[model samples]
Target chain A: MNKHKITGFQYFTVFFFLLNSFIPFLGFHKITMISNQDALFSIIIGSILMIGFTFLIKRLYFYLPNKTLFEKIKFLFPKGFFFILGILFLLSSCILLFVTQEFTSFIHFYLLPEVHQFLITLPFLLLIFYFLRKEQEVIFRTSEICFYFYILFFIISMFGILPQSNFLKIKPLFSTSISSILRSSLYFFLSFPLPLFLLLYFPKNSLKRKEGGQKTWIKSILFSGIFLFVTLFLILSSLGVQLTNLYKNPLMVTYQKISFLNILERVEATLSFSYVLLYFFPMVLLIYLLKELILYAFSLSPNYEDLVLLLLLIGNLLGNQFFSFHTNFYFSISIFLAVFLIFLSFYSFLKKE
Target chain B: MKKTKLLFIFTLLLLFTGCSSYTELNKLGIVSLLGIDYKDEEYHLYINVVEGEQDDGSLQKEYITYDATGESIDEALHFLYLKSNKKIYLSHMDVLVLSEDVINSKLQEIINYLLNHPEIRNNFELVELSSPMNILFEEKIDSKEISDLIQMNQEYMGTSFSVTFEHFLEDILIDKNSYLPLISFDKNLEINGISLLKNLKILDTLSTEETVLFNLLQNNINQAIYKNTTIVKNETNIEIKKNQITFHLKTEINKNSNKFKENLQKDLRKILIYYQDQDYDLLKLKYKMKQNHLSSLEDSNVLFPKTSLKFDIKISYTNSYLERRISK
Candidate 1:
């Protein structure tokens, strides 16, 4: 009885928003800041795979009609299956913590490096927590408010990054194999828009089988592909493949190199702030997923999203010291495990279907 | 439940207040620009302290130079702090200026200090002050803030490059060598510098031209206006065309093991030449002449134009459109 209509532009904008989650966090899109990792090459190819896999995932979901992907896992596998998957998702949250910390540290160093780093992150985390405590309507409204600025940023990032790009270095594009690209795509998918799909908590029935519903997924993926290309191209052109590899933070160097005249330089603040607004959407989604997982596991449907925020506050503090980013991408969940997750989706859905 | 939640909120507020505010923005005294020079076995610290300078609205910042000596930069800074009216914080410090004495005598200590500071953001513009450190502080750059103008040099114009604090970390941490954009002030008090640092260690500065060449070779060409690109056809007037490169890398053949030996080298060379379209005189021929080490070729042909040169040259009217295409 209701339609949430999103245009091609909205679809494209959402893709940028999805990638934006990766951008603001310091190490998530580390390819742009430092291109040395074997994982860096994946940005280009991974983007393509993410697009391809989205379609396949959707088709697979159709076959297991009645259940959400997570539920299918609980039905199909033994008792501990969903719990293990929940832990994997928790690891993803840890990686996100590293990324957010890295980014905030970067912003503090660039914009107000003299201020205690804790001061910088404190404001951000507090703001994020305050929103997390609120209702979904407020969060969605906030995303709507921020999305306008995100579009403006995407346009500016393209222009700002374009002139500085060196097309020549785009050579040897396939320096990394197709496998590397797929791995990078997995990195994007594990923590991003896919995880955000846990927002299916509404009383409304299944996502419509209509074309528009399918477009939501397809359009977002396409938008991400274009974003990935631009980011890779910008980093490659600005830092050069060699030097880009050397710097731990390549985007910082790229921004340093960007000068309109001479007066308007050292804009790391503008970049970091813009990204904060953008990353908030996914931050909302992150908390939302945590809430859904706990609720679905116990079947306590009494609206505990706010309570989830409180848990995150404690978890967020403990998580600060839980893991170091050195292990971020070096350790990936295995292929067999990934397949098991896919299987869980099928079984969880079978009973419901 | 409401009473318990209120108590928890009150406790959190107490905990926050109990902890020290990490670093105070103004009281900590953000060192927006830093100048270090070795003077008479003593180290001098010149701080472009960014603050509301005077009652006058015209000048917004007061750049102060503090001179002190010790076994370490921190010690010297401590001595300077005792003399100064405010605290000296180097976290927001953007431009690190090394006087010729410090840079020449070896910048190992200064570089080490910067590397260790947690607050310094690594990618900062390492500059060389032409007129002694004191003179640099004296020059009134027309701007609201001294730091503001310093950024203008790098941000608005391709004139000066900044080696950010983070960039310094990258270069210093790298295995091989690192390069940084150098900053220099003219007699008229204008500042400029773009040079490379090899492995985060060096006093050697590349001229602006050499920096351009290095950028081109590395393919970091954001914008380039070659002074005079002279085609060596007849050594007359040379019309400049687009110059670009594509890279081809081998699978790191180990020479010690000597697996393919001759065949690999030959195969790799063929790939490189083929990828670049070596038949083109501008691309391969120029590189060849350089390889043969022609002394005459070193001469600037485009500027003097009348020098007789015997070399095959080609030019095609590829529109200079990198910037144009990006804009559209």
Candidate 2:
């Protein structure tokens, strides 16, 4: 096995954690608002759509097993087009800075109310900078280590939150119009599997064993989809549709209700910290992707990689100070990236390069 | 050179640690209970702060009541901060008391404030008081005693139910009405019954007996003693038909099952009729209808009063230790 390549399980952990982190912050409230009690159905349909999309991407991966999506785009598209693609990747990476700002705002509002936003953002960005300086395999290995704790905390939290869940609140399902449910499902698709386009940046050769990697990817999607479905179900049932729509972070609010045998209470802050940990994985990955794009786009030597990363972190910190991105902004950008990925995959397949 | 760089990095890490936001424990006036009242176009705030350590090593936990008034809750809280020597910490608060005037006029503001406040958790119990400051002043009741009283009454007598902030908000949002356990002071703090609220105002108050039936209908009772009978279990099921809603209450009692069943059915019907006359969805019948997808009627509020309500009660006698032996 190649030392630099990651194991299929590590890849699974990376995608699983990435898929799970995005929903509670971005997709959950919007979907619940649109479909109401039928949000669970939206997740079900959305997962199937996501699985189908993953299969198509898997086929595309098999067609060009040795090259990353960027290399393949460069191989097929014109030189100018590849530069445009590089710029798009750069823009996408920059858009992810809003997530850093959001993370800061969430911590400032919920955990450390008295702490300055810069205090939170500075250390957070520094941590990301340190992680980005490491090899890509290190990030995957870190995700593997964190995935166990994520699952353990999730199971422990469920033990406390499940008893409070009232299934009656999920009643009258399918009462929402089909169009509404479909629209919500589209939002889920945009929020979840669409972002998995980032994973395609790694070539098939980047995995230790590419044969089983597709199965791992599909399994991870299924697992993360089930986790999100259960979470949305619990939020709706425990909070009801009206309350679910009322709060910005309904899942965190639901976390406040967790009490294990009435002995352990107020573990929301701890659970939310775990959520912040999950957010770190994607941030590091985005910065790494940005570095790669900057190097490839400018045809720069490898020595400037660290300098490019430093510039990206500073740029993100400055960008966060000026702009505030909401769910619509994320949805629009995600849709754009998903469409771009789909277009690239089909063009590569049709060109047979 | 590398060691120097590492030392500098560690120093930067020390700077990032939450020293800026840190406050010593002795500097915090831990608020255990908060009360709000509206009078003279101002908000009256009362907070019970837990302070003072014991002579022994163990904490003594003495309670101090602080009162302040302002045009808004935040301003009143600011005034409260000025009076208290330590920083007012509200995360540890166990209960919040709202006066009748505050509930009548400033309930929306109160809800918004609680919902938006970073320190205030929705897990704290919310209670209604006629004169919250007067009761806090005269009774000297802390949050623990008040929460315990409500919990005990809810579990045993079923004449009162504990309503947390989350539960209250969910009820209002889902059912368009909610209820709070009404607390009063007469020589000592006592739970009177419950105050019904709708459209951000107190509609009416339920008596102790009526509250028992209310808890029964809502399936909130764990174990209640009613009319010398120990109600071990209660399961309420609602069936909605075309123009009538039916309640099937299955109950288990330790003794006097037959007589208690008759009184319970009659009392439950009477309470339902009284609330129906006022067009109040006391039992959340409309919410249940909507949940069951049977809310076809355009104006459930207008037709609910005229709609027929039927009660089907099933009672089972649970044998005591001696009775079980005798039967065997």
Candidate 3:
């Protein structure tokens, strides 16, 4: 409970949680629903929905003031129901962990090919371990430290890409069909439910300054939503709609083109750094969820070593299958994630006893 | 207090480790543009190196030429890379200048090298020069201010086709067709406009007049010359504007032969009729007469420029036999 209660500024890294959903999907998902331009329109709708969903979650703390979405649902559901839902959520978090590791490795190959897998994996494992032992506030502050660099990079990338931003490629506007974009948006909304799942573990201190929490949460979500939309837009513009559809990883392809004046080249390194920051926090969040789920399932008495065992095993299992067949994993995981999200959404809203 | 030391050590370690991870400039030679030609039954790879400037402005270009015998373009490049001490960095390259000889003899090889090279970008300009490749950079050709003028003349005036590497690749790979700009350097090495490409290979290329006719088939011409539109006392120049190119098409099926005859004769007649019927030449002359008030050339304003656009018809036949000739 002491660890659960400690929330800090870095806790906002959960915003990046949603971004991971799409990033991994790009590398592995073979069933590209749309071309790059339409895919972008899909991503924009996703980012916007995510932004609104965060706002809705924040509004729940004040506007729907009686109980948290999960708590309200839990109170209504039978005891057995919560257990099944918890198990489902646990399974989803494990997959999230797998995807996070895979995407991080993808970045490693392009950005720092020289870096060994153990070295990159080691820091992340430590980050998860550090957050697992610390109180929520410490995790939040650590996330806050990481978040500042994340933001600094985000701002720098924005400015850096401006000159390269070919506006001509953005036109002819109102081109792609609206129905296609809405369907793509549903895919966007699928990844969004992760941060909403975190509301269950929020501390009492976080709830006290409800309005302040609302503002901070909303701003971060909006910023990240904009980040995702811009990322999609940049991918679409740099690699036209046709080629974007053909390529599996549009972001990597686009960033490979970040040459300014031929002197300051290779922004892929910068992008890789930024990408790790995005996945690292979400991954830690997933690890935290795993610890909580395991501790509850076995009644393992909140021991850190218990998690170390489970995670080391899980991370290795994930790391082993990381590059095996990305497309296959993506399809299986996306469908599973969709079903899990629908289950959670129904469970959260239905348990209002 | 302990965290401060921990943070310092981490930062110091990053700095130390970062040194080894960096991609060294000395080991990488920056390729600015590439040209591939065929000679002696081998692939000739030309890489234009910008060999970046030092702290001082004392920087000079270092051009590297790599040639090898290979079954494929990538094999040739790998061979070139193997022979060199430094890695060839190609992402910086902007212009891909193809020689006429290579474009004619081995276009497929040149295209494969450009399209497949991971270091090469799609947005780079694809220029074809008639003058030998070495003469392209003879003078420091930097007319940065008049970029629009240079592009229009190069791309539109049909001295060459303005094709980006990406567009060229995209058209050739996907659409199965592409056109590129043609270049010809004068005695002073001044590069001129483009020529068209029919597939991955050059088509029957267009001269200035044929280029006009070929380009007219596709509408979107901002300027054109109406050659011999007017035969006046001083022989005035005709600058064109507000032009439209509409085809008067008639497709007649010749049942006897079971073939389709496209009578482009209607379109030709329409064009000739329009030229002969319009007396805009006389109207322009009247207007100029009024503006000048018949005051000779001395009193004209610098800004007010005018030219008479007219038509002249000469009916003569070279192929007609005297025995078969009729009075006109």
Candidate 4:
């Protein structure tokens, strides 16, 4: 299979991957810390701000057809500049993979206490590794399948959770200080849609006719935005502000509470399975991007599966080893890396032909 | 074709086969009910483990109560784990009974343990135990029945309301004032009333009548019969069907209808206002406040009696009940 072009649904699958990876993991605690009751408002504002950036990336994507932005950097920029940018991109992807592994470790801590962290993550990493090696269509199709599972879990969450929510917990809305709202909104802009920047690396022409257009960005943003909004609102209303801050993973906390008539207990374990399944797509995509970056940086041959394997193994080991030290600057570093990628995207678009 | 065949087998093996350790059922101590009592600066943990099997190819549940004491609930559980030959599993735990002493000063400690333990499911119903642990855990008394009683109270009883660990956590996070259905042992188990807790300490308890009123304020009452006085005592059966209330009042007095309803409202209002003045928001009235009342959340340190609740009294006299009373 030539395995180049992906349909609009596949493109949306990428959006779902980005959405599932971040919402409950990254934004839950940070939003509560910054805005408290004003979180939903701040998220809306932050999403609007992020959509503006995605629009700019869309403009840049169409600027040069049949070429990935990374390829554009290689073709247009000087050799030294391309080499440095490629290495930086690979480093950022590794950092992100490590950060995601920290959340995986949490799942181990809470759900699989009897199992070793390595054992918990090993199968997950291996599955993603297999996904990374498949034809692009297979990867896309698999993600499209997992997208349905995500929707199923999402519906379960809605029916399982919404009635239990105390709407009064969302009181004093729009009452947070201006500084707090702004700070949270800024946090949202920095973390979310940053990972979406990785989509820029996919060969633009790989998108089938009618894919990778204005509608793609709009649909991606709308789906992700509505999902984020509902999930965040449910967390805030269900857990409230104080308890939201108390749990490291409030979404998991909310999931564990999904019992109807005392029979539907332990749904978190099931939902966690869905979450880990959905997370594989983005993780594999990031690893694939990192491998390509490394190849482009070193002028290596295409047959470098060993290199991807080496990178993933070393990344997983280091992620588990330096777990505690990574927590302090995890968000800040992600934001910085995202901002850097955006800058590169804009520079490629703006440079004289 | 050869490559595709190999890949298919590989994927199937990975997907369907084993990756981690799996424990057999007989090798685990499955806890069905847990009781915590704090005394003399130490935490006492009691667990009711369901044990044994039958020859009928079915498992027979035998409640075996085990007790352990330590500096913390975690330490206590650690001791329990070590003492047992089988690994203790709490996933099937249905009820958590906390002694009054445990509720008073050790609630924070208990909550911390509950939050940390992955084995402890959040659906456990919490109740108060005034009886000694030894008596409560006696082999004669079925420990499992207590949890069933709690379920009954939550689903059917009108005079009390039950709080799950999830609800308690949510309430504590929001206001630190909440209520739990109280179960007491007086030779036999009984749903006493509801305990009003502030900052996890038992501030006071509502009588059975008061709990019904509390349920009314919370809109949690399904069907309840309440007796209150208005120059004469009347037993009224109240049922809330689809947001509308239908009450059958049986009064034996030739009293003015408006005054009788007014007295009922007065009694309800008095209890609510009294609790509000004490800053024990048992009804979560603060939670029900609109956006304009948000200032109360910020100035929570200052105790201001909530006076926003209004009562509109409507009465319908049933001809049959009226005639029966008149004949009497």
Point to the candidate with the largest DockQ: 2
Error of 3 at A300 (Å): 3.8
TM score of chain A per candidate = 0.73, 0.94, 0.75, 0.90
lDDT of each: 0.51, 0.81, 0.51, 0.69
| lDDT (tens digit, per residue) of candidate 3 on A1-353 | 43233343444455454455456554312212442245555666665676665544543344334443444444445476567657656555555656556754664555544576555555555545545556545656666676668678766666656666665455444444677667667666665555555543454345324323555566655666667767667655665554555555666666666766778766767665766665666566666656555554555665555455457545644554543444345445555654554455454454443
Model 1 lDDT tens row, A1-353: 12233233433344456555555442344553222333445554555665565544453445444554456555455577577657757754765566556655666555555556555555555566666555544555555567777667656666676776767555434444456556565665544433324332221124333422345655665666566556656776665555665555566556655555566765655755565665555555555556656767767754665676677755765566555565344235323334544554345455544
lDDT comparing candidate 2 with the true structure = 0.81
The candidate with the higher TM-score, 2 or 3, is 2
Which has the better DockQ: candidate 1, or candidate 2? 2
Q: Each model: TM-score of chain B?
A: 0.56, 0.90, 0.52, 0.78
Leading candidate by lDDT: 2
Backbone collision tally, model 2: 0
Q: Per-candidate RMSD vs. true structure?
A: 12.6, 3.0, 14.7, 5.1
Model 2 lDDT tens row, A151-172: 8888877777789988888887
Q: A164 in model 4: Cα distance from truth in Å?
A: 3.6
TM-score of each: 0.62, 0.92, 0.62, 0.85
In model 3, how large is the Cα lDDT of residue B238? 28
Q: What is the lDDT of residue B253 in candidate 4?
A: 36
DockQ, model 4, C-alpha based: 0.31
